[model samples]
Target: MIRILAFVLTLGMLAACSAPPSSTGDEVQRLASEIRSLGPDIDPVEAERAARIAYSYSAQLAQEYEITDPPLVHNAKVNKGLRPRGLCWHWAEDIERRLDQEGFETLEMHRAIANADNPFRIDHSTAIISRKGETMRDGIVLDPWRYGGVLYWSPLTEDTKYEWVPRDAVLEKRRLDQHGALLPYVSG
Candidate 1:
């Protein structure tokens, strides 16, 4: 069942990414509907453009960073330097920057720190979009790096791979810098 769902999502993601950017209400409504399917209150036209920009930039980063299959772990000796830029966080930043430019009227893009409470203190980072001023706990996790460049997104609370709580402590409530680069915890 999970495989089927992933397949469907991948197809939908690729289709949305490939479609040319549009401002038509119909196109916007369609794309917005799909994003909202995962639970977000975004303008469809804005959502369409955001996805297109994310995908396009991901491709560019993949090439520029020399990304390879089985994404490189950030800070790992194998991932150091400009050679293999496959860190999942890199993917997150790429998408974050693209969406930041779109600047949604009804939504705010967040640089979410996932699994901030891990025993090892490691956190996985990703891009999130939610209604303006909503909590990170309420955002949708848009993680393109997890699957080696395939965009994986779902409601943060419902995300299966990691717990995307607001901060290391649920009460901390911190936001990532607009630069969107975490000093550490870039592991996948």
Candidate 2:
């Protein structure tokens, strides 16, 4: 009975962590529409291309990262040197690097860290895309690590689960905090 129960649980987890559905073109179109809504100056062609790349590259990374486990499980594997890479920061970094290659004329990419100020939770890193003149707060979050490589995106303000801060600002505050100066945690 115990063996059967264990097997059932394992199967359930695997099912829950399976690769995202096959109809990714729908996702691409949805993301492109959202990107174009950022501002009037954003080029529709650039938005479409960026959306396509974001989804496709995330799928590519999932295969490269050998992501068969849930996000936290993969993260533990990465920390234990059992896996090469699948962490949130890895996704953010790789996506940002790939997107940067496009040299988008009307769009810009930014990196953000969430839960940096909360000692009880692990920090989450993600890539954000916004109009060239805007900041990360005004961008759309491109997060692939949350569901083991399935792409999840939302307008910054609409991502209710995370309160994101600019990555540089978070790092700088941590630096300052390390210098015997304590900074209060501010939730955005």
Tell me each candidate's TM-score: 0.61, 0.84
- The runs of at least 3 residues in candidate 1 whose Cα sits more than 4 Å from the true structure, single-residue gaps closed, are 1-32, 37-41, 72-78, 82-84, 167-188
Per-residue lDDT of 1-188 in model 1, one digit per residue for the tens? 99978865655564444322333445334435556554455666666666566556766766676555444332242344646555656667777777877767877777766665577545677888777777767767777666556555667877776866543344344444423556666689
| Candidate 2: tens digits of C-alpha lDDT, residues 1-188 | 99978866865675476454455558999999999999999999999999999999999999999998888767777998999999999999999999999999999999999999799789999999999989999999999998778899999999998999999999998887787556567799
What Cα-based lDDT does every candidate model obtain? 0.61, 0.91
Q: Give the C-alpha lDDT of model 1.
A: 0.61
Candidate 1: TM-score?
0.61
Score residue 50 of candidate 2 by CA lDDT. 99
Best by lDDT: 2
Q: Could you tally the backbone clashes for each prediction?
A: 0, 0
- Those runs of model 2 whose alpha carbons end farther than 4 Å from true positions after fitting are 1-25, 181-188
State the lDDT at 88 in candidate 2: 96
Worst lDDT run of 10 residues, candidate 2, spans 15-24
